[model samples]
Target chain A: MTEGFDRIVAAVAGMEEAARSFSDECRIVFLRNITIEGIDTLLTRNLYAERIRPIVQFGGYGTMVQDVLAADGAAGSDADLIVLALSVDELDASYGSPGWTSHAASAQLEGLFELLASRTRATIAVHSFIGPLWSEQGLIVAAEDRDLTSQTAALNRLVVEAVRRHSPRFVLMDWERYLRRLGAESALDPRGHYLWRAPFKRAFLEVWAQQLARVVCALRGRAKKVLVLDCDNTLWGGVIGEDGLDGIQLDRHQYPGRAFFDFQTTIRQLAARGVLIALCSKNNEAEALDVIDHHPACQLRRADLAAWRINWNDKASNLSALAAELNLGLDSFVFVDDSALECELIRQLLPQVTVMQVPRKLHELPPLLLRDGLFDTLSVTGEDSRRTRLYQDQRQREQLRSAVHSIEDYLRSLETVARIHRADNGEVPRIAQLTQKTNQFNLTTRRYSEQDIRAFIADEDVEVFSLTARDRFDSLGLVGVLVVFIEGTEARVDSFLLSCRALGRRLELAMIARCLAKLREQRGIEISRAEYLPTARNAQVADFWPSVGFSVTGTADGGTRYMRLIDGHAGGTPTFVTIEDD
Target chain B: MTTPAIEGRFFRILSSLLQVPLEQLGHDTSRKSCQAWDSLKHMHLVLALEEEFGIEFDDAEIADLNSAAALLDAVSRKVSA
Candidate 1:
């Protein structure tokens, strides 16, 4: 009877299960990268529209690209596929004829680089991995090979290129991978309804939904809201105030103490990965700071933490303070503490916070840390990289404060030479990232992918102004993106986002003023409209238009949209950006 | 003397990631590993092998590792059972 049940399970498990078994059997299957012939189906209206339906329906896909024919026949330009699994309501908001739209979920400026990469010469490959199709009644999954050698690759690339180039938002979930995954899952479940798949032999729909989730991740970027770190037992063995600096155990000698030193180093590495590390200690701050500095075994420095409310403050409060200083929600942070008391406290106070309890032992730290790292991996985008050096530049700029009298004089003193260029294929990724992350100065706050930004430029009516400002504070790097959408010679400043690292220097005002004038002259537009989409983080720009000499149109729905007509060059603010290198 | 099949077990494990399964795994397969053996997979390979043999390799060893044969030879030293 058991053998019969096993046979029945295998039979009913369907192709999805078969696929999993295939993976387990070959269990050794390698990722086969086959290039493509060309991207044609992506540009095909039927399939492009078809794939978008499920994403708009099931995934929280607010924006998507439809059909696009590449202006340039470029090679080596790849596609980042997205699978959209949306609810039924969100579907119609996208999948509309022509332009695309979606509700603002996730951080606006978060996936800018991915957006930009998906646009321009890049392809915004969209696939319907989940949700019910327009006429069909099941999940939709589309993803495939995108290299030039294989048919699947060619098909996906073509769609990706089209999606990347044509629309501001796109879903990228190829069907091929979904089917394989579905097959695998089904083979394992034998019941097809579970994660593996069932009811259908092939179970392509499940693949579609799962693939859409993957694509959404690529688009939204991982929300790395917090960096949880262990104290006392983890950072330095024994309590800080209790054990004292010399007394505390770290990496080097007895027990697994050295691993703590390595553990700190790993935390520092996470910081580089853009995870904001925080301290949850049952120790004194001054003493811990001393340990961070004086301890030869210490891997993380005091400056590495964005915020630490070290004291007898319950770890919940410490985690809260860290969240506030980092300007992130408590729900966004992952809290790691060795003490069960602290972890439990944070768990109670900020239930949303990801609190990890370290084992009483030290050797278990690395594996636990590594697994957590996977959970919070923020599929790094181009703009993500700007944080470490950008913050470093900001800190260095802050040091030169007393040296300058007024902010304007400071701007002038920095010998700030900004190179403003039209958004090309190469610069779109950086521009998209800026558009996603720069909230304090972002005007419209319309988050875009590299693919969307590329398409934005290809529209003669749309102008994207990419600015790279290097002041005497430091080369803030390619720090700003200004997008202007024009309609019948009337232009609307769609988005103006600048890095927070470059804030407080009046660069946003100066750059926007300059770009608007430039776009006005180049496009010969009469009026340029800009809006202040009030986000919790973007209040700084709430009065930006009024401050910069643009008339506010009206305040409606709690957002202020404004416009101005510039017949001549919008004057450049002779700003000083002092370069302070690390 | 060990069974040649031991090496086959190593290659078959690699085949899941390397794409070149048991049939193609030769001793001279060399460090040019396989087309599928990209950097990301190299990381996963290290992780899987660690789980398989309950051993850990530093980043230094990761950089040193390349071919299936080289990995197996290294694993042979680390594994007891």
Candidate 2:
């Protein structure tokens, strides 16, 4: 069994490389197949029962489709998702028939889909194999005797194409291809099968596990709302610390340092694409700020960042203080450190933080951070390009952060600008990413992917909108998202969340104001209703409903529901903010 | 494509799977003295040898597979058959 599995492991390693390449274009997680046929069939059965059963215990698998030889339904309740590894004898007779597509087929597939979908807790069996990734869209796949790789890719394309066509909420891995890619060595592997379910590489598995964590995050609206970056050695090389001004490399150049500089440029551009970039570096503040201020090839400066945190302090404390000052979650932040020891220290102290180790080899930094879709983006919005500059503009909002120490006075000052736009097909992807990530100020705090967002929008009662805020210092890139369900004057707030960066500025009030305005203008209502459910993070918003003039209502399911009637509507930003109409 | 090379490869696979002493696995040595040469080993050796040689073995040949010479004769007949 060990030697067999060794072969299986080697084969899986080779296929794992292919899996990476295909998943880049399409989402084919893995392909695994094993046949246990030998003279000692009874012995093989015992091995399957004792050894294999436990391995697939948490995996999603279907029952052998006796005649069709396909894995068709959930193997059992614990088996959330799966495709069966069936032999020719398992193939069912009605497979190519018409009656099978009737109500029976409906009930059959539905039961299977439900078996796995309910395990959305685990939701497995996203794919199967016959020839390859796409031999026939209808069935899992027909196992081809040869040309395994080509067949696997084809099946993968089929699954993706099917997903695109039906728009069903499915995330699947391809096993046949995954196995062949794993090869004969892995095929014969006897590590028990549990290891096969893991990614090709153990190091890569950490990233995959992180992705699962992200899925949980987006599910809970706990996505990092902003990324606070540092200038000098952090963003570019040479620093102003010792490199003095011009010595710093900012653009593409010679080996080593040039790559670090290029990565910094990529970071600046990523910020523009709507990753809230804030400069948080410890320096003379002025001397260090000068490199950004006076560099000839500098792609970013005070004008490009949403905010700047330049002061002398231990970076771990600085990052923690940065989170508190911004009112963002510690879990939602990714801190990059050029110093290995610093990164390690931060990793030890603040494990939740995604501390990216700036490779000692400078050039490798950019590609390392960018690949595997670290900042997996499904869509980029029109509001993104203006992000860096908006942060610079937002400085005006922050100086105001102190100008009116009182929250109300802060709201009253600096004429506020907020532009609310209904998200359409073009904006769905970003909207979904936001809905998946935004918490804190979030009302209902429901997370959705681009695909899920589109499906949710199909319901008539739900209305979704994104908020773009610009204050004296910055035009915070689409910092707020609002999801509301309505029945006449009673508007149930399904999900309302704002980027924490936009918190000290009272953008939540702006989002609510917009909601009220939409109710009156779009829905033709003079009255509006809302709710506030207490969450661990959004306790600040526990009183948000009452503060917004919402009347106390009864609590059910241990959740406080609020109601309010706006006689006349004014959905707009505060005095300090000026909404940029998209 | 040549028959001789294929048959040689067949004998080589049989020798390994059956654990028959290579020197004694000649054309006439029956399955009598080979300690590993049992009915079950016979089938396993046949399956693996068939895979390596690309020839099918019948029940008679499978039964008659006592010595290397007998195995060769049975395999050649199947190859021709």
Candidate 3:
């Protein structure tokens, strides 16, 4: 079954199961001023299937503001997420009236958002107001005098402003855009709404639930990070081996070539957003490299890819090798191939990796890639935008390493500098992303959300440190994170993770030593406690703590615990590396 | 009366939507006979039937379509028309 179909079935089954039982995974409270009963089953079911147990608590009808106020005052609110499902009509009481203006509506929305921001620490998702299609004012509504369309557009803009004002905590679910995509008539059943007070049709609810599930997954740090592409007809119109470099259809001017150009452009955009792109093509290595390097129409270059497997081998084995080279799991990869047989082979061999078959028609390929929303994320962090450059820098560093005689000499020659600082507001997202994506070099494979990282920063007992590395090549932005929970004269490390791209340069050791030196300056830190949590992908860092002079304390919960004395451990920053504290 | 070919295809669609065996669903079978024929499933049945037969039902026809016989009759009239 297709992933979408499987999710739908799981959602349907989850809805049926949720009606009979409660979810333990997530507690989501829905505060809406409209009838949104139709969405409960669909949302709960999809989230449940994703292992996010959803327990929905609905506010009384048309009492969203009042319900939020109550939730704010209530002690120990257990909700992890609060969904504000607001409608345009609810925002503007004069919605259908002839005297409608967006002035009051905008003010009211801003006030509501302000109240929501102040009252709740839970992740808030506010649904953007979608205006009704059939207006009583009719075609005259388009006129400036009776302009409901312009007024509604202004209200939507106000919602975006509010989201910006309360960012990382508040997210806007663009229901207006969603309705436009699904078509208003199909999304809303007026008869059903009037008969049973159902605001959305069942079909609309199903799709909305799926979209919401993706958003939730993104929030929970479970988004796929890699896109493994096949290069034959997948990237271009014809095979590079059969069709000469000039004959390949990848130009922006021609018919099929334009389609391929558009596809490559989309792939580049995804790469810019930190989706690691790798090539698994069955072609002559030199020929493929020549096409990528010299092609005028090629948007993706060798620098854009983290790894490539261009050889006459099975794609499944190539994908495994790519995963190993990149130090990422098979689960984090999405395989896109034009051949159905190749797609099937990888799907069977590497069941964990998501496999997508390229469309038969060249024109359909771009839309097919964009439609699934597989790489949907809540917010784009600095790390995301800088990922392509970082990978390119790593490739350059690899080349530098190959030419040097010894590892120590190469490290010294690079003049690598480590800048260690207490993670500030701007660095929280990158820190959270590192905790989520950095599996190989992570001491403890504990995935944390941006919200969780923010909480850690706010807590007086917790200290979160982020380390950024700069060699002769490039500045590796926020490559390592160390979160410690401080107590009286003793600190326990909650998380210690470094990005794999910055591994093997002794940066992990530098990070630890600098963190320890800084802790020693505090005068009260006598000992540092750390743990090594073994996950399927984090085996590389199992002996990391012991290597760094942390004595083995004990074993518990499928992990080994360690403690190191901080007061007497005399360690200056490594002779080769320089540390800048901020 | 519907032809045997149309009836057979109609039964198959109904069976798929209702999740019931074709042998169990007859012309006389109604919402009362099938436990899964709740309001939600009923709406889904209407949508599925409309798409399967390439016909649209009015609000009145939809409300009255509570049984297999009624659905078949409504579909037959719409298809014939």
Candidate 4:
């Protein structure tokens, strides 16, 4: 559905008055060739509700090259994001010309990227140009390879290539896809281009701004991690309890049944990309498990889910229980159901969880689930695809916990091995992901991007270490990251975090003690310093540094500063765990 | 739609976009009288009107229809036609 422009303007007007009170600011610079005025208002309207203020600045008209290449001018050096929006008609000299070619256009884009890759630390978003609505060559242009459409296609290929070449820094905005969705006729306004060179219609601009806001949310690591679903009509066409398993409508080959089949398939694919699948249904536990494990048309199995609650309990309670079982915050959940009452109750009780009610039309189910991109993450790593298995492995560990008598005996029987090593360039994304997503066990709570992690890996004075652990049951992929900055004889722990899957194994102590030992032996670091910056979710780590034999030096504003003399301290890895380092 | 209905919708959009009160907008109101109706706001106002009414105005009409009376006259003509 399209948003009213007046509503956006009114919302932005209200946000501008209270902008200073927002806790976080996402500074975005739009380096565009055309007039892009109202998008900032739309972006503010999108991000303000989440307590993030977006400060949208602009480069001068047709000054993209000058802005990108500037060393200290009004480019994006201090900005969190830089968006390159191009108007091919204005920037290209060969547009609609007889001797038109994509050479100059591609070269210009490459030049901008080269400058941006070296000069700017902000995340770059480049727009993909679309074909014009009306071609100069008329109907003959439809079949010709030398037409403007073809040339623009060639240039888009170059854009894709450039994004690939400078990945994790540059992202494609996919304007051409949005154009195709809106259709060229409704997307562009020729009169506006003629009047002020603002090419896109207001509707198209709103959609484009929404897309960009989605990218901003993903980059800020605000993507939902869990998808909790109701079972009755949400996953199948009928209730599994009332209607027999044979009576329920879920067939991959039929009409209405195919829709639910496709919806399950989409949820499974989301699970493959690190979103934990969970069930919060009021059904007979045995029946639901039977449907999941034995139903021929079901795309998901019982093993795909990380946790579930198939009881008669209220949905709000079930959702909270699922979050606790998974050791995730309620804010990381996205709940979906076919019952309006259930959805409304969860929305009222757990406002942090995003709730989606199924649309009335059955065929619209899959698109509605994916319409807003609630589960979109910036990049998928190897740890992401194996996340569901990691949770299932946690279930096994819980079973093992109950089997053993003493805590030390339990940890020793598991035969845990932790490999703490200096991180290579390939582990930058996973390390950054841990820094962003790990909350309860994180010290200092400093979030970094892949670019920042890459820089730390390459810096001579900084050491970035990754920790991967394996027990008798399964291997937990890169589950911890420790960033240490060395200055003279002092080593400061800039960031230390462990994933929830790697928690409760006494591995954090092993990780830190091993790294501190290496820092003293190889890097000649005598005094080690770390801080416990308290956050809303990280109270569990308040006394962690003290437990590791670091004495408190000062306390201010509820934050504790810690320092330790590494030479005299007897910090050792836990006897139950073995640690290997590079 | 009746003229009063169109007038009511038009004034609501105009007041919201220009940040002007509905009571102050009248037939005699023009760009010279409204301090908030600058060139950029004028273009936005036109675009919003076109989108809301599901009609397009001529380029010359966009420039000439600066007064409330003239805008009403042109919109009425388009809607009725």
**For all the predictions, what are the DockQ values?**
0.02, 0.03, 0.06, 0.34
- In the predicted model 3, the residue pairs found to clash are A26-A53
Model 4: pairs clashing at backbone N, Cα or C within 3 Å: none
Clashes of each: 97, 84, 1, 0
Q: Report the C-alpha displacement of residue B14, candidate 4, in angstroms.
A: 3.0
TM-score of chain A of each: 0.36, 0.42, 0.63, 0.66
Q: Decide which is better by DockQ, 1 or 4.
A: 4
| Candidate no. 1 TM-score | 0.33
Better of 3 and 4 by TM-score: 4
lDDT of candidate 2 over A433-497, digit per residue (tens):
77777667777777788887676577677787778766533566777777777777667777778
Ranking by lDDT: 4, 3, 2, 1
**How would you encode candidate 1's per-residue C-alpha lDDT over B1-81 as one tens digit per residue?**
224665655665566545455577676665574666775456446645665556666545666778766777777767644
Indicate the worst ten consecutive residues by lDDT in candidate 4 chain A: A401-410
DockQ category of candidate 4: acceptable
Over 4 Å off in model 3, which ranges?
Answer: A1-11, A14-24, A48-51, A71-76, A132-146, A197-199, A399-582, B1-81
The true-structure Cα RMSD of candidate 2 reads 23.6
What candidate 4 gets wrong by more than 4 Å, as runs, is A1-4, A69-72, A133-144, A399-582, B1-11, B20-36, B67-69, B79-81
Candidate with maximal DockQ: 4
lDDT of 3 by residue, A1-582 (tens): 122322343346536655545333666778776666646666766666666766677886667668777745221266677887766676666776775788887777777778777776777787777675766666564567456666777788887887887777788887887788778787877866654455676567767677777767777766888899988788888987788777889988898998889999899888877898988999866667666776788888987887788889988889898888777899888999989999899888999999998888778887765676788787778988778677667666775755544455546655689998888999988888888888788888789999999999999889899999987546887899999999888989989998988987888888888888777787478799999988888888888888888899899998999999985564645677888877
lDDT of 4 by residue, A1-582 (tens): 355576568667866878779777898999988887788888788888767888888888889878867766567478888988787777785578785877887888888888888888988888788886677777684555788888889999998898888777788888888877888778887888888778888768878888778778888878899999999899999988788778888987887788999999899889888899999999866677777876788888977999888889998999999899999999989999999999899999999999999889888997766778788776778998888998988877775754544466557656689998999988998998888888999988899999999999889999998999997557999998999999999998999999999888999989988889889889889999989999999999989998998999998667889999997454767898988765
Q: Rank the candidates by TM-score, best first.
A: 4, 3, 2, 1
lDDT of each: 0.54, 0.55, 0.78, 0.84
